[model samples]
Target: MAFLELHDIHKSYFLGKEEFPVLNGIDLDFELGEFVSILGESGGGKSTLMNIIGGLDRNFDGEVDVNGQPLDHKKEKQLDDYRRGTIGYIYQSYNLITHLNIVDNVLVSLNMTDLSKSARKQRAIELLQKVGLGDQLKKHPNQLSGGQKQRVAIARALASDPEIVIADEPTGALDSKNTAEVLELLEGIAADGKLVITVTHSQNVANHGTRIVQLTDGKIGEDTRLKEAYPTNDHQPEFKPKILSAGASYRNAFQHLSYNFWRNSLIMLGTAIGLFAVLLFSGVGNGVNAFIQDQINSMINPNSITVLKNPTGKNLSTTELQQSLSQYSSNPSKLLLSDHQINTLKKVKNVDKVEAGYQFSAFTVSYNGKNNSGQSLQTWTKAYASDTIKTGHAPKNNEIVIDKSQAIALSSQKKYKSLLGKTVKLSFAWVDKNNNPVQVTGNLKIVGFANGGQAGAITATNYSTMRNLLNNANGATQANFASVNVKNADKVKSVSKDIRNTKENNKYVFGAITVGDILDTVNQYVSIASIVLASIAGISLIVSALMIIVSMYMSVSERTKEIGILRALGERKKDIRRLFTAESILIGLFSAVLALVLAYAGSLALNHVLYGIVKFNMVQITWGNVVFTFVMAIVISFLAALLPARRASRLNPIDALSAD
Candidate 1:
């Protein structure tokens, strides 16, 4: 049986339903140890035929058999295996990976092999020696002479121990001396019992082959034995190039990609930042949401039902009952929530606890014996009915708990020496619309302090004290509204709904919400802010993708000649595609890792400053963020690399070789 066989191969193209035949009824056979040359004019389908035979193109009808195994359309893996293991190709331009050493270029063919590293290295050295390139093993292809590069290309072809070596215009780019040297090498390969095939238009190269095949208009014109072919010594031994180990392909890809690091580094950095922003924002959103939920869970009674006094929108004209409340609205004060109303609300179903709190404009407190001259020293005033003490304990009858801010203020005055047990007096005069000031003082012992240091110097007393202070001067019995705390956490929502539905006329209850609902609402607010910031960060990443596309496209253009060479050297289109993708993916991966590192550093710095401002450690960096960022980087890289890879795969070897 012949080592290789081609039976009546036919290939065509469809241009708007018009058929263009590229190859027609071409049949050929070759045995081991034969040197053959194919000669044809330009545009005669020589490259296309070579592409099909090398498994780079499969759009054809023919029976191509090697070693008695018929190439089947349904068995693409079989064809790929045959190309990978049984055929070696040499290109006219010497398609060596520019970034890799000569030995690494040869080792690329061993990517799927099971050979050990040392064994592969030994075999690579042997092949290099056979190709007269032993001294150039560690040198990159750009540093080699044209003839030396061809020698390296030949060595690479022998890497996989293939029985056949196919050369497409092996001497097309060389001078006469180099041409003779490369043609002589081909003769030696054929003499060593390997079937050597060359596609050339040069008579000298054709004269070296054992047989000459002439092609015209995509069909075989002649297949003749070349009796005048160059003679070679019959004793030369076959060269076996090193086969790469299983993991060697990735290493080779890294080495090949390394040369272009400067171009791709920024792409990686951009992608990493984009990935990091996604993960960091997600993590922060989740963390803040969880913390807010927990904070509400702690501060609010497990069974608290809150009733809002006013709707989020204005609906004052909707009810007659609201008219009765017109007086409160016209001259209403922000300090409206009342403790007496809270007691009334406690009568609702399943109510175990009741409280009222009101928020008023931040008012100035005298500090260091001097009140801040303007609103600059102002802090928000929040008065709770009871049990809002942050540290120490809640005040008893005739006692008060002031915030750390208030304590600091009094200490600064030097009238009160220390904070722990110091008494600080906060004086405020109640007034009516007539501007009549009514003096009220509930002198009490200081029991505890609020945690927000120097920010909220709050003074907490019993509900009755605050109420008396408000009504005696302001003349209002009930203010804002109330909260009814249920006995069970689950019953809080149910009770809130019941209270709102108690009477048909009670639709003016404004709004009702449980503790959990309030927490969720607060967290949603925080999430929206984070998402907006993250979205802003996301725009920068899209720019990175654009950069990646530009970089890959440039790479494709720059490596056109190399790509053509690889195609002629038995690299399938998919292989070329993967090579491009590998480079892009590596850049993305690097960017992702760097972004994560930067984000982590940023979070730490933010946490340090924000904890001081917010009085809590809410910033948290989690493992989920790191993993998510890394994955995002990879996905972005794949997306960025897709178009470039496709372009690389579809590149025409002929046009590529012609590109500058």
Candidate 2:
């Protein structure tokens, strides 16, 4: 029985409704250990017949039987397996992948084998050595002479140990010496118990084969056997589906990208700029929030909630109430918190203590006839005990801690530091029981200089002290607000909410505020600002994605024949897609890493310059930001590569192989 058989093969090319028959009914038989040449003139259907035999042009009508099994041309996977396991092709153009070295080009075919990586490498090197290009294994195809490149192609063809070796004009580009060398190698391959077939228009090339078949007008006009077929060993390697490892794919991608390093670097820089802006802004937002919290923490107790009287009923809008609160003519009765309201605040959950305080919208301080008038004042409570004292001590009975600036103004020597232990007189207007305003006065000893006191004078005395002076002067002593201290700082927010939610007569009675609440509002604004800025910066990333798509499509166009070579080596379409996708991912990863470095550097520089003024790091890059940046880069790159990769994978091998 014949080792290979082609029965009644018919092929035609269609131009619209017209049919141009390329191959008529042609029957052929072949055995192992035979060097057969199909010789014909140009346009004699020689290459078309070779394409059919190589399983690349599967649209032909034929029965191709190999070792007693009929080839199913319609099944793409079957055709792929047939080409990968049963035949090896050597093109006249050498068709070597430009980015791969000589040995790597050969290994491309061996990679489809189930052999281990080391074994595949060894086999590829052995094949290259057999072709007499062993020392040039690391050289790229462009570095080689035409003969050397054809030698590499030949080595690649034999790397997988295919049952049939098909050479299409193997010596068409070589000189006489190189032609003889390649012909001798083909004869040697046939002697090793494999069928070697060559298609060529040169009669001298056909004469070197053991048998010659003449093709004329798509038909076999003559068949001649020059020598008897040698005995066949009939041993073939076990067939395995092609599996391109991710590592191999990435290595290929890296090599290809490295060929155009400067171009790819520019793309990475464009992408990195966008990523840097986003990461930097995000870090700045984080730092600003932290700084705000730190300042709030130092200024006020986080566990304390300031409860203000609801100046207007629920019928009033928030804006109207704020306007009324700011006005001095608004009724003081509405702003004053009664003892009953204070008691109700003490009932709030997590409330450890409630302290009543009084606020004077306007006041006057007199010391040695130096008067500072129209100053705001607040009576001290336990919550204000934590205030830092720059001089003297906390206020005692009939004593006040004045602002340093006010102390300086009232000092005869024009030095506030010298007035710490001095005495000052305070006077303010308050409402009496008859709802009429009256003046009140008190002589207070200067104790300490602290914040959160009178706006201009820094005067703060105990609530009892202020209340006593008002009561004696026939003035109302109602508290303006109350401070409710929670058991823990973390419970301040919940406790404050509960107080604000407290209702009486179907109306919210008290408004509650805490340092945490103010900080949260500030942080929310900062976050919104950061997102808007980052989104504007992200426009560059979209532009970068479009750049990637353009770059990848160019790559597909430039490496069209490379794609054809890989497909002929038995690579699946998905593998081709992954190869291009891998290149894009590498570009993204490079950009992301570069962006992170730039962002951190910028943050360090900004922080270093601002450290003296702000006394804190103003940019903080978190691990979350780094991770999110990387993920965004990869996802965007993958999406950008999709169309290009699909186009590359779907390219017709025959047409791609024909590309320049």
- Each model's C-alpha lDDT? 0.68, 0.85
Local accuracy of candidate 2 as per-residue lDDT tens digits, 479-521: 8889888999888878877887788888877777777667777
**Residue 112, candidate 1: C-alpha displacement in angstroms:** 4.6
* Model 1 regions more than 4 Å off: 5-28, 38-82, 112-125, 169-188, 200-209, 212-253, 270-393, 403-412, 417-457, 464-519, 568-574, 604-620, 657-660
- List RMSD in Å for every model shown: 7.1, 3.6
Best-performing candidate as measured by TM-score? 2
Over 47-75, each residue of candidate 1 has an lDDT whose tens digit, in order, gives 78887777666678988887798877446
Q: What C-alpha lDDT, on a 0 to 100 scale, does residue 373 get in candidate 1?
A: 16
User: Candidate 1 has which clashing residue pairs, if any?
Assistant: 110-244, 268-591, 272-591, 336-480, 337-480, 403-450
Tell me the lDDT of candidate 1.
0.68
